[model samples]
Target: MEKWVVALLAMSAYLVFAFIVGVLAGRGRSFWSVSEYTVADRGLGLVLMWFLMGGTVFSAFAFLGGPGWAYSKGAASFYILAYTCLGLLPWYLIGPKVARIGARKNFYTMGEFLGDRYDSRAIQVLVGVISVLAFIQYLTLQIKGMAYVFNVLTEDAIPIWLGALISYGIVIVYVATSGVRGAAWSDVLQGILMLLVAWVVGYTVVYSFHDGVADMFRGIEASRPGFLTVGAEGSGMSPMSYTTILLVSVIGFIMWPHLFTKSFTTTEKKIKQTVLVYPLFAIFLVPILFIGFAAVGVVDPAQLTGPDTILPHLVTHEMGASGIVYGLIGAGALAAAMSSADAITHGGSVSFGRDIIQPLKPDLPERTQIWIMRLSVIAIGTVAYYLSIFGAAGLVQLLVGAYGSIVQFAPAVYGALWWRRGTSTGVIAGLVAGIAVNYYFQLVQPATPLDINAGILGLIVNVVLFVGMSMVTNPAGSRADEYIKA
Candidate 1:
């Protein structure tokens, strides 16, 4: 058989296996139950929770963009590692509280949790709109990664749009049919597969191209001086930019609607355990960066299409026609992209059904809501697919841009949980102001004052408005006290 054919077959096998596993995961679960489809009945075990959380966070961005940053931006890539380490710390304190409250209130989405707390439907609708928009940006990156892998490994036999449609089409089927169970179970397989591939590929590429890991760095350091050091002269990123990005990530990490809703998937004890063990997953990313650094001098920058393609480009060209190597990289990259995409897709559907549709109609039947969520899987996937193909931003760039808006939810979330003075008008005003300021800085003006992350700047304005308005506005009465007590 030809090399590309053999490689394609290997990738095809993995996709088939993932489809079977994902579909079967929903076999015994209640398809019509809104609770079952959205949060696995809030009974997920520790192991499943670990992989679901890890796999969802470490998306194609980590597998592809991690190396891309190392290859293109040098040490600035370490921000990914830094943020991952600190991001979940706040979750430890907040996750249990949110889980307890969610369980009591029968909350399955962040919008529901906030809407009930602040006593405002407008806030729920705003959150729904923000979450779905951010999800599309996020899902776009994962689809791009999947399409890039199939197109490259298959030698472009599978066009970008078709490849995305095929892989994500399977994801949509299992997610729509099986719900969160499909996403969680499949993540178990994907999480294990991608970790094994990352280390093996990272080790092989380093030695294949250079004497060793140490020698690989030595060559780059000697040739490109300061590329390995952040904020150094010629490093491509300044210290303030790096610092602000890191800060925003830590604040915004768990605020992601998909991740926040995970608080309802399992118990409070398991939530803390997941957060504690989450840092080890960050270790898996170290080797992923090695793959990018290994390519520094070996591959010419001008020849490659984009920094994100460096990984697959090296695997196909330098691995000497070994179909196994091509297949391994293809499956692993797909795993990274698919794992995250499934969860985001599932979350987006739930958000649409629960936050946007239910609040507006208020009397929609439970069965009708489930069907809407199921159909939303296709609708949301279609929008994200269009963006993935047409969007010009880099993977990490897309992620950070999404984070700015998501981080805007921080004050409202924290206030709902702890503060008694929080009022509906205050939450609405803060959320709107924060989102507007964030957009203005992010899109309207790229050059921010003092080089702070646009998200952080918006957050500053958001806090002021939220607090100032709440003090003047009447408290939410006994309901606010009851919510905080819960």
Candidate 2:
């Protein structure tokens, strides 16, 4: 068999194993209950929570986009590391509170908590809409990443559309059957495999090129002067842009529905302990960056067709006919894609079932809601599969832009937690204004009026509207007050 075929088979085998493990993980449970399906009865321990959270965050973007950015834009790529570290930092404090409240209230979705806190179904619907949209976009990136890996490794023998369908189809099946429990268990396996692959790739690049880390930097300096530093000539991004991107990601990371919903799955103490170990998860990314740096000076950026393809190109070129390395890389890439996709597919289903469907039909049976959620997994997975096939060139940028709207939730969420005066009117108005501003800025101009991210600009306007409108409106009544204190 061809090396590509062997690699593809290895990846397929790993995915099959993951599905088996996922199915087995939830074996004795009654998935008919929303609590069992959505949040695993809110009883996860630290180890599973750590891997699930870390694996979801360190996605295909981390493995694929991190290196791609570093290879193409130089120091600006450090934004990946910066944003990741800073993103999880806030969770140490915020997560425990969310977990405590969510567990107490039996909140399976973030929308449920937000709505209950504000005593407004409108807030629930709004959060649900945003969560679904952002989850779809996030799923699109993972699907695209999987397609790119398959296409590159197979040299287009397997078409991108078919590749996406095959991989994402498996995700839908597993997630539909097992929900968050499956996603978490599969993530543990994927996380370990991908980490090992990252180290191997890093070492291979260094060894093959006959260069240590110091020598690699020296080569980059000689060929691409100031490449180690930000704002060098030929670097595609400005320092200001880099800093703002990092800021946006740091602030926006936990706002993701998949990550936030995980708060509902574990205990408060477990959540805090998970945060303690998450920084160590960030350290696993260093080797992935080293792979990108190794490509510099060795592979000309201009010669590469697209930044996402850089890693695959380097692997195939460097490893030659070594079937084992190729298989390992393919498995790692598939793991990254599968781990992320499963969480998103599961999260989206929960949002649709718990927040959207139940609210529309309050009398619906819990078993029916569970079935609807299972079907939603397939529905959402299919939509994302098609979108990934037809979407833009840079999967990471599209993901950032798509999910950027979630940051608008910061005001509503924080206010619900701390501010007693925040009203439903203010939250609705602010979300609309923020989304409108963010959309206009993204489509009309690449940068905001002041060179900040469009989302940041929108967030400023969102906050102003939220605060301004809250002061103008009547304070949330005794129920809202009680909910906040609860």
Candidate 3:
């Protein structure tokens, strides 16, 4: 069979398999139960929680973008690997407490949790808006990554728009039908497939280009100095930028509504176990960077359209691997993108209904809320799909922008847990100020005095303002202490 045909068939089979897994996993749950839809009735075990949380973090960015960074920026790509291990460790300290409160309060959304703690509906709506924007930004990149793979692997036999629709459409269906259960089960399959495929591709690419791993690194370093390590003294990213970016990501990583809300899906013990096992996923990502480095000397940079294009380019032009290998690589890339997208789509919808719409209908029936969340899934998916196809921003830029905005939520979240005095006024003001500062740095003057991301700089202001505002305002006599002590 022809190469494109083989790859296309493999990708198609992968999607069909994923769909079956998703639908089946959601089976036997109560159709009218909002808890079932949003959190699998808070009954996830250790194994499922492991995949659910693990797969959520290993996004399309990890698949395509990880390699892209390694290929383009050299050692700067190591920043991704560095942060992943640290990012989820804090979950051990916080996840159980959050989950316990969520179980006690019947809270399904982070916005609800925050809004209740601060005694402000306004904060809920504000978080709802932020969550929606950040979610669409995050989902757009995953859709774009899947589209890029389909476009390249099939040699444009599948156009970008159509490819995105086909892939993301499956995600929307499973999420709408199965909800979190569907997504969690799907992650079990996707996380396993992508991990295996990454190592295979990473190892194969290195050997295909040179004698072995040592020779591959040596060849790239000899050709391009300072490309294999982080920070200056090397010709890579500045040390401050590298260190601070990782810090921003690690701190803000759990603050993402999608990841944060996972607290409601499983037990406290399961969440802790998931946190313990997650670093292995970080370790699993190392070989992905190797695939990028493997392409350095072998593939001409001038032929590539973008850094993200390196993986597909290598598979088609340079790997000299069999047709099946090409097919598996394509499937693996889709698995990465769709696995993360389903969870984000599910989480975004729940946030929309709970944060944005639930306030409009506080007395709405549980069945009604469930339907609204399902509808929000489709609506959010459509908006994100449109942006993915037409948006001018690159994947990395969109991700960075989303991260900058969402990281501002960390102060409010952590404050809810530990700081008893944080009021709604303080969090709202801090969130607003953080976003403005972050936007100015991101768009108005991207080149700051230092190589620091605007997000990190914005975070410093965000924390300071939050603390200052809370102290001056009358603190809520709310159950801030109760939630903390629980």
**Candidate 1: global Cα-lDDT?**
0.91
Candidate 2, residue 19: Cα displacement in angstroms equals 1.3
State the lDDT at 91 in candidate 1. 86
lDDT score of residue 468 within candidate 2: 93
> What is the C-alpha lDDT profile of model 3 across 373-405, one tens digit per residue?
999999999999999999867777788889999
- Least accurate 10 contiguous residues by lDDT in model 1: 477-486
lDDT for each residue of candidate 1 in 1-486, tens digit (9 for 90 to 100):
666787789888999999999999999888799999999999999998999998876799999998999999899999888888888888887888888889988999999999888878888988999999999999999999999999999998999999999999999999999999999999999999999999999999898999999999999999999999989976968899999999999999999999999999998889989988778988888999999999998889887888988998898886574888888989999999999999999999999999999998989888999999999999999999998898778787799999999999999988987888888888888888998998999899959998888999999999999999999999664566665665
Off by over 4 Å in 2: 232-234, 318-321, 479-486
Residue 307, model 1: lDDT of: 92
TM-score ranking, best first: 3, 1, 2
Off by over 4 Å in 3: none
Overall lDDT per candidate, in order of appearance: 0.91, 0.82, 0.88
lDDT comparison, 1 vs 3, better candidate = 1
Per-residue accuracy of model 2 over 208-289 as CA lDDT, tens digit each: 7746888887887888887778766866677776777777787788888778888888877787788777677777788788
